[model samples]
Target: MGQAWRDWGGVIGVSACALPIVVALVVALSRWRQKRGVPARVAWWRSAAEIGAVAGTLPWIWMILTPGEGPRQVHLVPLRDLAAQAAGDPGTAVAQVGGNLLVFAALGFFAPIRVAALASPLRLAVLGAAGSIVAEVTQYALDLGRVSSVDDVLVNALGAMLAGLASRRWWQDDVTRPLCTS
Candidate 1:
């Protein structure tokens, strides 16, 4: 809906604006390292993935943590809030599900490629869940007027795990011999 899009306009705009800068910086850094007689082990995609992860995630986080006019809300029961939302507005429900899944997707997809220790679905899920928990706790603590629900955490972890699975082929091969040293 127009309202939903308008509400999320800032987040979308920020990510869109930062994308080109991130890519350019990544390219420049890659070139600089290569020119210094260092192997270009850090592929452009890796940099893009990392930068994109942060750029795409931060705006949503800001939106999440920003306090609204209303009082904060918490939903301790798993899926209760989600079910209610889905029943009320299917479109909103779908958008929420997709957004939650995507929150940590880039990190999940590219982290394993960059770090051997994180080259597993379980690790990615745990990491995503931990990050989601922190976000929820922050929302609750700050009285951000957002619903802190277990469903969000579960869905976010699921998204990360799925992303890890999607990148499994690359991770399995890359983990044995890391491409770049962080």
Candidate 2:
């Protein structure tokens, strides 16, 4: 649970917030310089490809330091006492969801900025899975006080996909809509 929160919140969530801003900034600057309207940031599909590649691999980097099971970077919540009674408690679920979404979102957001070939959702899934796999495999290999879990990979991948979906339009057209649809 501790690790989940870290993976999701620390990594995924941070990425979600960060990547888009950077991508937008770059696109904005490019527009500022262009004499004609900034040419739609290389088409919608192109943006997707760019976003996917970057959105996919970030999880493996931090997995190295993650321990097997954790109270991990402890946050103060009064419910810590009842942790033993539940497997699907609200607190635990929140951690898992938040952490996974964050890191994956980060990947999604950064994908456009970090890599130029991430336009396809399928491709994004591939990279996202790859990142999760590497993290799990690395944990297994190093015996670095962590155990790899398929669930993490699945959640991470899903989160990234969601991020991609959220930015579907960003990948499709240079036309800005809502953050999720834009």
- List where candidate 1 sits over 4 angstroms from the true fold: 41-46, 179-182
Tens digit of per-residue lDDT, candidate 2, span 1-182: 67556555676677678777758855555555343443455444344444444444455356345665542232234344234324657777675555655556657655643354675677767767787677667666666655355556666677777776676655544433223323
- Predict model 1's lDDT versus the native: 0.77
* Tens digits of per-residue lDDT for model 1, 55-171: 656776776776766777777899897788788878878888988998778778777766768887889999889989999999999877888889999888888788878888877
Superposed Cα deviation of residue 55, candidate 2 (Å): 9.9
Question: For model 2, what is the error of residue 77's alpha carbon versus the real structure, in angstroms, after optimal superposition?
Answer: 30
User: Which residue segments of model 2 deviate by more than 4 Å?
Assistant: 1-60, 68-86, 110-117, 174-182
Poorest 10 consecutive residues of model 2 by lDDT? 70-79
Clashing pairs in model 1, backbone N/Cα/C closer than 3 A:
none
